[model samples]
Target: MNGIEAPNRLAELRQAAALTQQEVAERVGVPVSAGQVSRWERGEQAPSLRYRHRLAAVFGVGVADLGIPSAPLPRQRSSAEDWFVSDEQDPRVTKSQDEWRRTRALLNQNRHSLSQVAADLYPEHRLAGTGLIAGGGWIPEQPVDLARIELSEVPDAPEPVLSGGEREAARMLPDQTLTRSYDRYTRAVRDLAPPRLFEDRVSWRLLDVDWSAGAGRMSFGDTTYFNAVDVFEPCAHELAYVALDADGGLAAHPHMRDLPYRKLIGSPFDFARRPVMPAISTLTIRRGAGDDVSFLLHRRDPRAVAAAGGMLQVIPSGIFQPSSLMPAGRAADFDLWRNIQREFSEELLGMPECDGHGRPVDYTSGPFAVLDQARADGRLTVHCLGVALDALTLVGEILTVLVVDAPVFDSLAADFVERNDEGTVVAERFPFTEGGVRGLLDSGSVAPAGAGCLELAWRWRDVLL
Candidate 1:
């Protein structure tokens, strides 16, 4: 077993035991401390022979069922001390040449034993018999193969079959809640790995939103290529999920789409190996928040986004998100905002009476504007975001409101919520501590526009015959 997989297996076995660390410690005859069992299960350390024997007896399995050497009490301490250490990172301790040859012979024997066990226990090994319980461990009696029995079969698998211990395991598995948080909280990280060797660039289209020009699926390299098409004006903070799959020759949509870690982590095969072929993720950031800005998103498919120094930054026109200094009004100077309907109308007819707001009540309403005022005990606190949107601009779209408090502005600007056209929300941060929301541009400021972030809407120009 790889050293890493040990923790995962111990957790599974512990759960099957229907015992808590406190209960398991008691049953295993370990010291009084409950945490010792927990630390052992976590792969932080190992326990003693007394504990191992106790665990095997209680679980009704061999000590090797846990996928590690039995922790026997030292016999002839001087001699065995040179063989192996319970907790040393280095396997090579001082060993005389004679002991080395003996150790190698024992290891070769163990390897053959493991090979036979693997052949018996694994269907892929094509061994004879029921092919189960091949793990070589010191046991007073025959050991059990827990995986060979499915939970659904427990009720009907013969009368006196459970051996008391298996029944205890079944009971414990249902109620056990032992846990370990895999969060690596170290904020400072150094590159022992090359930057390019990291996850390569990838793209993803919103699956449910539109699967046709669907984002390109994972190919040979690690990439989730995407095809971004413009959609209707999006909501302020409505959330959505992002899912991906390793594109296979099969043309069917999988029932288990959210492949990564989630409540429905699917079957044991999902986490036990390869953690499912694909993964699912989510973001709280909304559709139209400016950080996901892609001019191509407003036109063609957007380039895959990349990360550097632990932060994901948007790249526009094949350029990393520009630090073009904070805007005078905190927005790009270019008027990326447009009125396409007017252009369409110009191509089709002479002129239209409707105003930019698509209203007839008119710009004739003479200097129209809305102001916000907040008050305290006979005093006024000056609060302003310094920009405004023309009041008549909103007609067919939703407005994320954060109107400036100015006494004389005509437009209504909003607290922008952002998303790609497919509606997969772009988030500013994930729970990950090291490589989260930083490096993305400063989304810390406020803005004024019906959509304060980025304004995205489908645009098409057709020539009349």
Candidate 2:
């Protein structure tokens, strides 16, 4: 039989020590001929385990340092999926549908426990779990005239229908989120990171808002949170892309860390029950002749994952930013109005003069100009209908009710089609009744923000229709 082949440091060590094969054999107590040594050097023969140690000792090295190839070690678990422990005869077997359902139920039952575990495990991250205290101490400088609509009368949410995979993905989200506090009295947020895009800012004191009432409020207090900027590495945008690519979920991109911090944990940015972040929802109502009021509605593009694919929403809705509103220290109290105008200009009118992303663009035809002319002609009137919070996302909405006539609606819609080239918006039309709003909600296609907008709009049905 041929000699077993193996790579060893016999040749290199012998040369370095200025010793011959015979010398090494004598040192190791191996009764082998020099011809056998030559064969071993050529990987034509290997020594026994005991002899390997003796040979290593003579070479002033360990057996592993001899450069011999050993059997591969077992593959280590290093991904988020690795944390999902499984018990089965075949470890590679995929989970069944019933098993996934059971997994989801178990996760929900132990959500608080898991959150606590996460908090304890990542103390450096400052995770507060479900119990957090935020937003106390601060007062409003000036009174806000916006009418607060009571959402207590709103119906309870229907049971959600989610796939097994979707439920599992949702279980992976964190119980905390990010918030930016501008002093103890005011908590602020920007649409973009680095937060240096705009100059004017509006601030409301934390103590001014009442948190006892749900959904509609000027301020909120909840702190079980963490900064997305801290937990997500490289950038949050890259993390967003990966979440969309893999699970259609919004997750923080995890990176490899040093020992003891070796695991790549997903971020708790989107899923956290943090402080309420502000957004603007404008309901453009067109009154035709007598009492006929038709409200404008738009469908989001299917490619937009933020809305969970395509969904029906108001004509123009966007988050409020300190940079975009309150610029040059003028009209600071009118920040909500300014945000609504910008949303209209970008989403409905399709004007390139304004932008959603932080790119610098001048407003050639601003929203105020339309508001001014409409007010002058007595055809359009905008009213602030208060703020509401989303239960699932924890984001607050500033509802702006716009009353417009048919001529103005037609003019704006025509302008939107002409100015639009990018398919950011798929379609637009007028839905005149509360039934339309209810239909979208029942379809389970409207996003949480969109659903909030519809609820606020429904409250104005008496005047709208």
Candidate 3:
């Protein structure tokens, strides 16, 4: 009748006929079992187009009697010009076309449509009431209140479901050199070498990792034996912890504390058995020309020793550091933005490059300064779009949308690329179209975290747009 949640009369008709779902399935010749028919009755899945006619014939009613508009067969015309004439001449066709346009508008306006939201949040999972019927397209009949949507956590009432996609993505990483080559960074990235100098920077404690297989709960330990050839795994349970910096700031050293026995069973490329950690994936979108929005991501150089090399991914994604959880000083404020900006500079701005000698240079202050300038000029705005908790990982994303004048965008683009080239970052761009976003999603070069961030940005385009 409206969205996917609107009740269909199929169940009522079946009961009236004293027919079982199996009988209906047999009469309709649909390959699915009786349970699927029950799903349609429960408003879980809409019947596909191929089965609609069968249902109508079995129920001895028109398709419209099943709560869907009946589309007339196309008119057979003598000439192509006659087709246009026929369309203009037919009131039913014209009315149907108008109704379609109005319905499409309503669908777009209803940002909280249950089926659409389900598609966005759980692309990996298939719900009962949503599928593509030929004439009906994909029907999702549920209506939801946008205000009641959960942000930080999954719902306890309906329960969060895990699909196979998460495990698939994690397990399907391509085989490559897994170890980080620290020696290779001695020249260019000498300054950025992770300083495990202070006692607080490294977590010596072993963390127990255990939780419901599908829920966001996960376990992490320190990265004691992280090697260049080893891949990161998100196992069901593993010992891991956050890496910190000297001043009690977040260092984000991509190492996890894993026991030898746990490490033996996990392949770096497989994520099925890896531990999940508290982390953030940031999308700093910038408003571009009218009706267009832009965001930047960078590709890591293949030669770089960083975990994600030769990939176009979220340039600034990292786990929550110790400083965020426990500030060393009273004056230090707990803020995620501080870490996000730090990562942005470390990856995109390329501040960690070395001087003529192999000694480290100071590029630490650059990201902060740029952000401050952007804010002062009214070019920055930040939003927490909410948490995306999938089987592989649980992360809170901070969407920072920036609106810059043309002159500033050009200047920033040039500087961002030039600076990051010396470090791990190889290329950068602001993708602004659906095709471009899809390319990133399909790219094997995008980091998993970057891929997840890109997906969240695209699926939540309604909020950003």
Q: What lDDT would each prediction earn against the true structure?
A: 0.22, 0.42, 0.39
Residue lDDT tens for model 3, 16-135: 767799977666542556876887677656664435544654564555678743442343322322322222223443333233222222222221221223233234442221210011
Candidate 3 matches the true fold with a TM-score of: 0.39
Pick the TM-score winner. 2
Runs in model 2 deviating more than 4 A are: 1-273, 302-307, 323-334, 353-367, 418-428
Each model's TM-score? 0.16, 0.44, 0.39
Structure candidate 2, residue pairs in collision = 176-272, 200-326, 215-389
Clash counts per candidate, in order, are: 16, 3, 36
Model 2: lDDT equals: 0.42
Compared with the true structure, what per-residue lDDT tens digits does model 2 show for residues 1-465?
158544667788888867788866655542545665676676655554334544554554555666654532233422321332431212111112122222322322232232223333334432122211112311112222233322121123222121112322222232112221122100111111111122222322111134233223443221211221122111212223232323233243233232111132223222222223455677777778764666766665322222222445565776554332324422332345556666777677765524322443233345557665776687876665444433222234555677777887777767664222222454544465667766765655555555545565565556444
